[model samples]
Target chain A: MNLMMLLEMASQGFADRGAVQNGDQRLSYAELFSAAGGAAGIAREAGVEKLAVLDVSSLAVPVGLFGAAWSGKPFVPLNYRLTDAELESLASQIAPSLLVTSRDRVGSLSKLPDTQVMERDEFLERALGAETPTADWSMDPDEIAILLFTSGTTGAPKAAVLRHKHLVAYILGSVEFAGAAEEDAALVSVPPYHVAGMSAICSSVYAGRRIVQLPSFDPDEWLRLAREEGVSNAFVVPTMLSRIVDSIGEGAEAGLPGLRAVSYGGGKMPLPVIARAMRAFPDTNFTNAYGLTETSSTITVLGPEDHRVAAASDDEAVRRRLTSVGQALPTVEIEIRDENGAKLGPGERGEIYVRGEQVSGEYLGRGSSVLNDGFFPTRDAGSMDAEGYLFIEGRADDVIVRGGENMSPGEIEDVLLEHPAVADAGVVGVPDEEWGEAVAAAVVLKDGQDASSQDLQVWVRERLRSSRTPQRIEFRGELPYNETGKLLRRVLRTELAS
Target chain B: MGQLKAGSRLRSAVCDTEVMVVAAPAAEVELSCGGAAMLEIAAARSGDGAPAPDAAEGTQLGKRYVNEAGDLEILCTKPGQGSLGVAGALLTVKEAKPLPASD
Candidate 1:
C-alpha cells in the first residue's frame, strides 16, 4: 500500500489522540487525514501537476503535503527566506503549475510567473470546504514525492528529488530510533522547507503521535511549548541547544520534565554543550543524528546510552569515542574513500559515503550528487573507527592549511567551545601570505559574560597545540547559522577576510 | 441567544461624520464609502486580531496624523494613538462636478 494508507491507519489507530498542534490550533489524526484528503481534492482542482509549496513550519504544511502526494504530484518546498531574485530564478526552472503561499508571502510572488496562486485563505476555502477523499493509497513506491534543494557552496541551490520509498525509510528509521509511541508528542522547531523539518513532521505523522509545530525558533517559546504541550520528543540543532541551555542555565530545575528524547545534529554538537545538557536534563535521552538531505535526513544516530557513557567518563578512550558519530543505523552502510576512489581503512580520513534503501541512488529532478557506485559522497571529511563508528573531522571545504599543517576548523571550534565564556563558536581559515591560511575564530559569548580575544587565545593554547589554536579571535553578538542550524563557515571566512 | 446574523452593519457618527462599518466576523469584510474626498486605512489594531477599543476605554485618542499624496490627504490616528476624535475610519474621494462637454 502507498503512504496514503499509512495516514489512514495512523488516524484509525490514534483517532482519539492529538495528531498535530500549532499554537492554539490542534488536529487529531482523523481531523488531519480528513483535512489532508479534502486539501488533496483542492490541489487536484487547482491543477497542481507539480506543486511548489512555500511553507512556513506549521501543521498546515504536512496536511497540504499529504494532499499533494496523494494527488500524485511532487511537492517542492522552497526556502521562504530566499530573495525575490532567487525565487524567480527557481520558479523559471521549476515552472510550477500552482504556487502555494501564505497571505503574508503573497506580495513576494509579484516577480514569479503567472501560475495559479493558492494563498492561505484560498487553501482553506477550497481544501477545508471540499469533502474528504477516500483513502486508496494511490501512487507507486518508486514515484517521486518531494523535491528538496541543497544550498550549494558555489551559491546556487541544487534540487534533490526524494521518492516515496526514501521518505518511508526515513520515517521508519526515526520511529525506531526515537521508539515513538502513541503517547508521545514531538515538538519540531525546524522550518518545513528543510529535510530535517519535513522528515520530523512525516515521522510523527506516521507514528500517530502528537506533534507540536513551532512557526519559528525561539528559545523561551520552545521551553514553554515543551512544558505546555507536554512534548515527549524533539529534534534540535546544536546552536538551538546551546541557546536553550543558556536560557535555562545549568541543571534539572531549568529542564523539561516531559522531554524524554532530544535529538541533535545539523552541525557538530560541542562536547561542552552536550555534557551540560546531559547534566541539566539527566532524565532526558540525548541522541546525535548524522545525515544530509541526500540521505533522507539521517543514516546514523549516537543513542542516549552512548552519550551518557561518554559524558560521564573523563577517560581518554570514552572521550575519544564520543567524537565519533555512532555506527550506521539498521539498513545503512558507510564507506570512506580517497580521491582515487580507493576505499580507506579505519582511522584514515577521507570523504564519507553512504548507501541504504533510505539513501537515494541519485537526486530526483537533476539527479543526485552520488557517484556510479551508488554511494552519495557526503563531502564530509571523516574516519571510521575500528568499532565502525563514523568520526567526522570536518567538511571537505573546511580544511585549513597553515604553514603546510592541515587543520580541521571543527577541531579549533570544539576546543574554543570548552571555554566557560564561549557559548557558541566557529573557526575558519583566513588567507595568509605566509601560512597560506591562518586559523581564525568567530565566537558568541555567554550572556553578560565577556572574554577578551587574548582570553580565548590563551584558553585555546592551554588545551591544543599552538598550530591548532586560532591565531585571531573575533567576538560576535551571534554566529551565523542557517535555518538548519548549520554554521556557515564559508560566511565566517569571508567575514574574517573583510 | 439568537443566531448571529450572517452579516451585520453598524453606523457610528464621530465629529458629525457618519461612518457605516460592516462587520463580518471571522470573514473578510469589504466596505465602500459614499461621497468622501479621500480614503485612509489604519493597519490592523493588533498583530493578532483584538477587538477595537471600547467606549469605556476612555476614548484614548492615539496619535493623529495625515497621509498626503497627490490630490488626496487623509487624516487618522498614528500607531499607539487612541483618542475619541481619532479618525480610524475610511474616507472617499469627493465626486468632482461633471465637466461640461467640449465642443
Candidate 2:
C-alpha cells in the first residue's frame, strides 16, 4: 500500500545487498532503510508537507523519494534542466516545501516564500546523519506519493499526481519481489524527474536489484559504468540507444559483458538501430516498453522473445511485431476507441484507452481523466493486430515532443509571429533519426518584408529555449488551413518532408 | 478483516507469510492460511499453531496463489510454512509468467 513497504521488505529480504551506488558512495538495503527513516525524521521536523528535489540524479534521489513516503509527504522531483524563472514558477506551485538542490541554485530559489532550500550535499549529509525514526509509515493507499510536473499541450505544466496504490499496483503486477539475485545491478541513467527514473527506483528496490546512478548520460560513460558495475539491467530512451550503438563496433569485444536486458521507450526505435545494436551485443535482450506518465510507467511491453522472433521470421506479419509494443500486462485491459467513445475492433487505429489499478489519470487541480467506463484515454493513436500486439502511430494531438520533452507549437509560433517581418507561422513535428522528431515551421512573410531563416531562428531562441527553437524553417506564400480555420498540420508535414 | 480489495495486505497468524490481494471475488469468502483465518497485516501474529496436514504445502516467496474459479489471486511477499486456502480449498501457485520486467 505504500512505497516504504517495498523498501522495508527489501531490507528484510537482503540486508547486506547494495541498494544504491554513486561514485564509491553506496548504501546497502539495511542502510537505505535506515537512511529513509532518517529522511522522514528530517522532513517531519522541518514541518514541510512535501519534499522536492531540484538537483540531478544522486544518492539524494532515492533518499528523498523513500524518505518522503515515510514522512507521509508527497515527493516532488522537479526538472533541473529548466531555466531559473521556470524553476521558480514550479517551486511556487509546491510551496511550503523542502527543496533539495545544488549549491549554486540555493540563493535564488530560497527567495520564494515558504520554500526552504537545502544544498544537495548538506541535505544528503543531514539525511544520512539524522536520527532514524521507527518504521511507522502510513499504509493508506490513497495518500499522494509523487508529484511529477508534465507539460501538456497547454499554457502551464500540470502536476501528475501518483498515489501510493497506483504505484504499488504497477510494481506488484509487473515485478516479482526479491526475484533478482544478489549480484544483479540495474543501471539508472535517466533523469530523476522522468517517470522512468521514479519507477526504476521502486522496481529495483522491490526486486532487490542494486541501483547505479548516472546523472548525465554519455554513451562511453554509460558503457564504462555498466562494465565496471556488472550491470545486468538497463533502461534507455531510443535516442540514447541509437547513440550508444553509434559509439561501439559490431563485435563481441565491444559488447557489455554482463548486460542481460536492455529496454527502451519514450520514442520510436528504428529497426536499423536496434538491428545494429543486437549484432553488437549478441547476449543482450531488447524490450520495447510503451506507457504514458498517467499510466504509471510501462503498461505494455514487447518482451525479449518477441524481438528475436520478429527479427528472424520471414513472414511480414510476424516480423512487424518488432515495432509493436506487444500486449498489455496480465492485470491491465487495453482498448482502442473512436472519438464517439465507442470501442473499435482489432486492426483499427484509434485513441489508446487503458484501464487498470495502476493507471492514475488524475492531475493536481483538474478532475480525473478516466471516463465513466473506467478507461483512461491515452490521447495516443495506435492499433493492435489480431494477436494483441500494439503499434504506436503518433500523438493524437499536435503536441511536438522532441527528445522526450513536450514542446508547445503554439508557443513557438507565437514567438515567430512577434517578428515584424513575419505574417503567419505554422509549427509541426518532422521525423528525425535522433530525438524522434524535430521542430519544423513553415512561414509566410509580410508584404515587402525580407528576413532570412537565421534571423527568425535567433529571434525565437532568445524568446524560448534552444530546444524549442525550430530546426527547419521554410518560407512559402501561405500555410495550409482547412475550411474551419484549423491549421492543417498533416498537410504541412507532408509538404515539408517532400 | 478489511474488504478484500486489490491492494489489501494480509498476514498469516500462524506464520510469517504475508500476501496482497490481487484479484478478489465478487462475494466475500473465507480466506485462510495454515488452517487459520488470515488476519489483517496490522494484527499481531500468535505463531503458535502448526500447519494442518491437508494445508502443509509451504508457500513460496514472490509467487501468485489462485483459486480454481480464477476470481481470487494473492501474491506472497514473505515465505513461511503456511499454505494459502480459500473456502477450505488449497490455492495453487501460478507457474511460468509469460513476460519479463519491462523497467
Candidate 3:
C-alpha cells in the first residue's frame, strides 16, 4: 500500500535497469532502493513529521520521496521559485520537517524553528553512504503519501492531500506493470513541486521506464538532451511546447527522431501551437492530458490515434477534436453537470464532475469535497460531445454572464484564434451599464501580420452569433502566461475592466 | 472460505505464489492454488510441500488471473510454481488493455 511497494516491485523485477538519471549521474533500481532506505533511516533519526524538498528536479527527489514513504511520513515539495517571504510562510506551515534544498538556500531556510536543513549534495552523499535499513515500511493504504500545494493562480495556495491508496489506484489502473521497453526513457522537466513531476516519477518507476531529469527547461537544452540521451517519451506544459516549436523554426526538421510520444497539459493549448508542433515533430505521437492537482494527474487523454485522425480529417467536427482533451480514462467516469447538480447531455456546457478511486478532492483541513454519490466537483467548465470527446472551456469562475446569458471564454477565444493574423487571444466579461456585462477580448497577432480590432470583431461575428462577439477588442504584443503555461485571465480581466 | 474483497492479499499454502484480490463476487467462493486452499498473506503456512503435478502450471509476476465467470480477479504479486483455481478449475491470465501514458 505504501509508495515503497512500487519501488520494491520494480527493484525486484529489474534490479540492473537504470531508474533515474540527471546529467551524467545515474542510479539503478537496486541502488535507488538502498539509497531510499538510507535516507529513511536519516528521516527517522531526525524525527521529523514530514520530508520536504525545496529545489528543482534532481537525484534527491526520488530519494526524498521514497525515503519519506519508507519512514512513514508525508513528503512535501515546496516551490523553489517562491520568494523568501512566501517560502518562509509555507515552510512554517510544515514545521518539524526535514528540508532538503540547494547550498545557497540552506542558510535562509534553516532559520525556521523545528527544521533541519541539508544541502542537496550532502543529503545525497549521506543517503547513499548511510547504512541501509531492512524494508520495514508500513502497508497502510490510508497513510498520507504526499502533500502538494496547489498553484492557486486565483488566490492563496492550499495543501492538497494525496493518500497512498489514491495514488496506487491511479498507477495500477492506468499503467501496466513492466510494460515499457528495456531502452525506454522518459524526459521530465516540470518542477518537483508540480503534480505532473511527482506522477512522472511514480509512473516511470512502476513501468520500468528510465527517468531523465532536466534541472530547468530550455528549448535548445531540451532538444540537446533528447538527442543525446535517446529519450523516447516526454511531458511538457503548453508554454514549453510552444517555445520548442518556435525554436525548431518553420519547415525545418526538429532533429529529434528518437522521440516516440509527447504529452502536454496544465493549461489550454492554442490550436495553432499544437498544429505547428505536430508538423515540427512529424514522427512523434501527441497526447493532450487534462487533470488537476486533486485528480492525481491526468483523468482524460486524447490518444495518438485520435490526434492522427483529427489532423487528417476534413470534417470540421472531427478536426476540432485536436483542441479537445479527448475521452475520460477507462478507470474514471466523467459527467457535465449544471449548477443544480443535474447531469447535462452532450454538447451542453456545464461544470466537470468526476467519480473514481483516484479522485481525492479533500484538502488538508477541509474534509472531503466529494459528494454523497462519490463524485468530485472539478470546478472546470467543459462540454462532452456525442462521441464522448470533452472540450475544456476554462475555469468555471471565469465564465462570463452577459445580460443573463452565460458564455464560455474558450468558445470565443477559439473563434478568434482561427483568424489567420491572430496568434493568441483571451476573452473576459467587462462591466457594462446597460447589459450588466459585455464581452471583451485581448489579442496578439502573428509576427509581421496586421489585423484591425474592427476586422477581428467582424471575424468572430461571421462565425458565431453577434451576441458572442467581442464588444471591446484590444491588440497587444503578446498575451501574459504564467510560468507553467496557464493564462493569467484574472489579470487580463482586471486590466480590461479598468 | 470467506468472501474475497479487493485489496485483500492471499498466499498459496503449498507454494511461493501470492496474490491480491482485485475484484470478486459478493458471494463467498472456494479459492485455491496448487490443489490446496490459499492462506491469508499474514496467516501461517500449512507446510513446505511442492505443488501437485497436475496443478503445477506456474504463475508469473504482475499478471492477473480471473475465473471463468469473470466475477473474480486477482493480481499475482509474487511468482511461483502453482496455478490459481476455483473449485478445481484453473484460472486464465486476463489480458490487460493499457491506457495511454499521461504524465
Candidate 4:
C-alpha cells in the first residue's frame, strides 16, 4: 500500500488529534492530510520525478513525506550536514526534482541543472494555501517510496531503495493501529534522512501519536520539551542517549516521569551509558533496536521487559543479554552464517543473514544484493545465544584478523571499556609484517582518571587471552563518532597506522 | 479459488469492502467475502448478493482478518458490511499486539 494510505487512515481514525508539532506550529491529522495533498499538487504540477528534502526536522518533513507518496514520487531526504560540494553531488543524482531546502541554500541550489528549488518557508506557505487535489495516490506496492543514501562509513554512499510494500509490511508487523493514547506525544529528535526517522513518521501515524519535532538535538532542549509536552515516547541514537544521561547526572528522581518508553539504536550502546540511563529513568522502558537501512527499520528489538529481566537475572548468560540487540521480530527470520554460506548454530559467530517481507535488499544503481535463496547478507558480524538473543559484534570489516585468526574488535573493546579509567575505546587491526596484522587500540580516558598503556594491556590480558590484547595502544581525549554514534573505525585505522 | 499472494488487492462484488492480502496460505483456498466470491480489483462489483446468515458480521477499516491456521491475512482498507471467509469458514479479526515504539 501507499504511505499516503497510512495518513488517510489516520485522518479518518482521529481527525481532530494533533498529528505533528514543531516549535509554535501544529497540525491536526486532518490538516496534515490536506497539507500532504497540497504538497502533492505542487509536486504534480512541477512535473518532477522525485521529491527531496534538505532541511532539519519540522512540520514540512511529514508534509513532504506523505506528499511525495501522494504524488507517487520517491521521497529523498538528503543529509543537510553535508558540505556544498557533497550536497550538490547528491542533489544532482535526483535531477529534475523538487528540492525543498532551508532558505539560505535556495539561491545557490536553484542553479543546479534540471532541479527545482523551493525554500522551506515558501514551500510551506504555498502548500498550506494550495487546494488539495481530488485524485488518490497509486496503490502499486512495487512503487518506490523512499531513497535513503547510506552513511558510507566504508566508502561512497549508495542509494537504498525501499518500496511501498516493504515499509508497509514493517509497519503492519510491528505497530498496532491507534494504539497510542491521546495524550501521548513522541519527541522525534532524529533527522529525516535516517531510516529510523522515516519509519518514526509512518509508525507514529499508524499508531495515532502526536509527534513533536526537534529540528536538531540539544540535551537541555530535549529534556525541556519532554517535560513541557508530556512526551511519553522517544527514539534517540546511542550517543544522544549518553549525552542525555550525562546531562541528568547521578540522580534518584525519575527524569521525565511522563516518559513511558525510550528506544536507542543506530550505534553500539556502551554498557556504562545504558546502565546509567536505566538508573536515571527507572520507570522508563528501555528498548534496544537494531537494524540497517536495507531493512525497512527495526528487524529485531530488545524489548523493555528483556532489559529488566536481564538486569535482575542471576544467570550470567541472562545478564549478558543486556548488551545484546535482542531477538528477531515475529515476521523476521535471522541466521548466522559462515563465509562459505553455511548456517552456524547458536554461540557460533558469523555474518548475519536475514529474510523477511521488510528486507529491501535492492539498491538504486546497484542491483539487488539479496541472494538466490532470498536471504540478504547483512555484513554485520554477530552471534545468537541458545535462547535466540542476537549479539552484534561490529561490522564484518571491523573484525580484526591477525595472522589469519579471526577476532572481534568488540570483544577486546569490551575488556578495555571495563577498565574503570577507560571512557571509550576502539580496537582495529594495524598492518604488521610479522603477523600480517596486529591488534591496536585507541582509548579515551575518563576525566580525573588515569591508566597507562601497559596497565590497560594487562587488564585486557587478564580478562582475555594475551593474543587478544592490544599490541599497541594510544590514549585520546575522545573517540571519533558520527552524528549517529557509529564509531569511525576507518578513521581510527588510519590514525593508528602511524 | 486459487493462490493469493501478499500485496494483491481484492474487492467484494456484493459490498464496498476492499482488502489487501497481507499473507496467504501455500495451499489453494477459496477466499470469499459476504458469502460471495472475492474478485480482483479490476472486476466490477455486481452488488447482487445480500449478507449471508452466520457470516453477516461487518468488516472494519484497518482490521486484519485471518483464517484459523493463521496463514492467510487480509487487511480491510475500506469498511463494509461484508464478513471475510476462507474455504467456507468465517475469518476472525486478528488481535493487534502493540509493540514498544521503536524508530
User: Highest TM-score among the candidates is held by which one?
Assistant: 3
Q: What is the per-residue lDDT of model 4 for residues A1-498, given as tens digits with 9 covering 90 to 100? A: 788878887887799999999999999999999999999999999999999999999788999999999999999999988887787778777878999999888887788778898989888888888888874789889999999998888897789999999999999999987889999999999999999999999999989999999999998889999999999999999899988988887664446788999999999999999999999998899999999999998999999999999999999999999999999998899999999999999999999999998999898978889998989999999999999999999998788888889999999998898899998999999999998899999999998999999999999999998889999999998899988899999999999998
lDDT of each: 0.67, 0.85, 0.91, 0.90
> lDDT (0-100) at residue A370 of candidate 1?
67
What is the Å distance of residue B61 in model 3 from its true position?
A: 1.6
Residue lDDT tens for model 2, A1-498: 789988988987898999999998999999898889988988888898899998889999999999999999999999887887887778777889999998998988888778888898888888788878877898889999999987333347788989999999898888878889889999998888888899999999999999999888998999999999999999988767766877885453456769999988865565666777889888999889998778888999999999999999999889988878999999799998876878899888778999999999999878789988889998887788889999876666876779998665656776787698986788888888899989999998977999999999999999899998999999999777532123667788888766
lDDT at position A445, candidate 2: 92
Poorest lDDT segment (10 consecutive residues) of candidate 1 chain A? A171-180
Encode model 4's per-residue lDDT on B1-103: one tens digit a residue: 5999888889887888888899998888788888888899778986568767666788987899999999999988777787999878999999987677887
Which is the winner by DockQ between candidate 2 and candidate 3?
Answer: 3
List runs of model 4 lying over 4 Å from the truth.
Answer: A252-254, B1-3, B14-16, B26-30, B39-50
Candidate 3 CAPRI level: medium
User: Please, what are the lDDT tens digits per residue for candidate 3 over residues A228-306?
Assistant: 9999999999999989999999877897878999999999999989998998999998999999889888999999999
List TM-scores for all candidates, in order: 0.77, 0.82, 0.97, 0.97
- CAPRI rating of model 4: medium
The whole-model C-alpha lDDT of candidate 3 against the native structure comes to 0.91
**By TM-score, is 1 or 3 better?**
3
Candidate 2's DockQ is 0.58
Error of 4 at A84 (Å): 1.5
Candidate 2, residue B68: CA error in Å?
2.8
